[model samples]
Target: MSPQHRLTDLPATARAVIEDRTGPLTSVDMLSAGLNSPIAARLLLDDGTSIFVKGMRTDHRWVWTQQREADINRHTQGLAPRVLWHLTGQGWDLLGFEHIDGVHANYTPGSPHLPLVLQTMSSLAATTAPSSIDLKTMPQRMSAYVDDPRALTAFDGSTLLHTDWKPDNVLITGNRARLVDWGWASRGAAWIDPALWVIWLIASGHTPHQAETQVRAHPAWNTALVPSIDAFTRAQARMWESIARTDTPGQWTHHMHQAALTWAKHRQ
Candidate 1:
């Protein structure tokens, strides 16, 4: 991954935009976590308030993600960081968010945080995707992975799906797990989000069956059709396989591919 940009590195116009909303920026602490974004930092204002900021060059390939994240945060209720403002200037697109005091969730087996993560997923599943946001459906996303495209229909739904379930994306805070990074947010089957988390569980050392049992607490997973589940598992395996074949496969991507394969084998 590329090195993230520091607030001081931003152009005068961008810094001015941030200061315009948040009284004079007094200090900046850059956060090095999060894989997709180029900027993640906490800005302390002169008024003693702190806010999180994430941004990227307007012409970057993933530039759209900044706007997508801003849009999804508006509808995420309390599941994600609240967007305070979005700005575009001096070649960068930025979003200011309410700072969250929390740590990334641990998804390993026997971790107490699992239940909270599941509960958060359940609440997120119940939310209807905002009608105004143009979201990509799961079926459309997984179409290229499945041999029988018709199987993709099983993933069709209006539920908002935070398709990325990496531990770093989930924050455990005060008896609940707060989700962040809405770049991959999609509209899909309510159960699909939990299903995505299952892969991460396996990657984090849970047996495939054990991971499935953990997610069963969600009503959507409990009542999901066997065929739909099978189809999704297979599709996920293929998706990870494709990702692992990238020019340079990261350790996590390779592990996820192995985990997806493990889950698909268990389904068989």
Candidate 2:
């Protein structure tokens, strides 16, 4: 089976470059769906080196974002898949990451192992990194996109911020936890990672009470506790508004709104 993609919109030269990189890609099959960006899957070279390629919106592509992932994985000591290449030319940007090996964590409600996973996350968070990413100016719209304002405000200076620490962003295997997709990484407030983790926990299936309680039990999450629920509420409302405007009319969105309301009610 081969991967399938829709890159007819890319420039001729860019398409050729993509094909050249995947040399003899032969064909493609849908590997994953509903991603925010266009993606393609290419086979691992005879050397056992494979890459996941993605094209990003031109205006939003930045070197800092690409370098951040490279640096984070570099410090991860192989906890993260190696970033094979990153190219930003031809008014288009592409990121090539070594394929990940495990499924994203699935947090079933009341799962006994939830606590252990979070504890492990805190331990991973404690690891100091040699790479220092600059965030003197990250996109101002982050507060608008993320559901936590406190999380964004924590971005006062430079810290190891894996801004998108959702469950889907984490890959766990055989007691080893690896972090991926550092696209939204920032500096300032290491708690940023766990804070994102908290949101993902609740979103995945755990109740707010469960997420809040268990996360706080970890010393790392304590520092990044939601300082202002008021701000978070504002962010949540904005998230719903944005989704309503952008997402296509569909059942998933129906569930999205339902989920938002359910989460909000859980808070009350």
TM-score of each: 0.94, 0.68
Error of 1 at 51 (Å): 0.4
Determine the backbone clash count of candidate 2: 9
lDDT of 1 by residue, 175-212 (tens): 98999989888998899999999999999999998999
| Model 1 residue 214 CA deviation in Å | 0.3
Q: Which regions in candidate 1 have their CA more than 4 angstroms from the true location?
A: 1-13, 247-250
Model 1: clashing residue pairs? none
Candidate 1 local Cα displacement, residue 225, angstroms: 1.2
Candidate 2, position 163, lDDT: 57
lDDT of 2 by residue, 104-212 (tens): 6666677645655675666656655444544433225446555554466644434455655545566766666666666565554555455445555666676767766
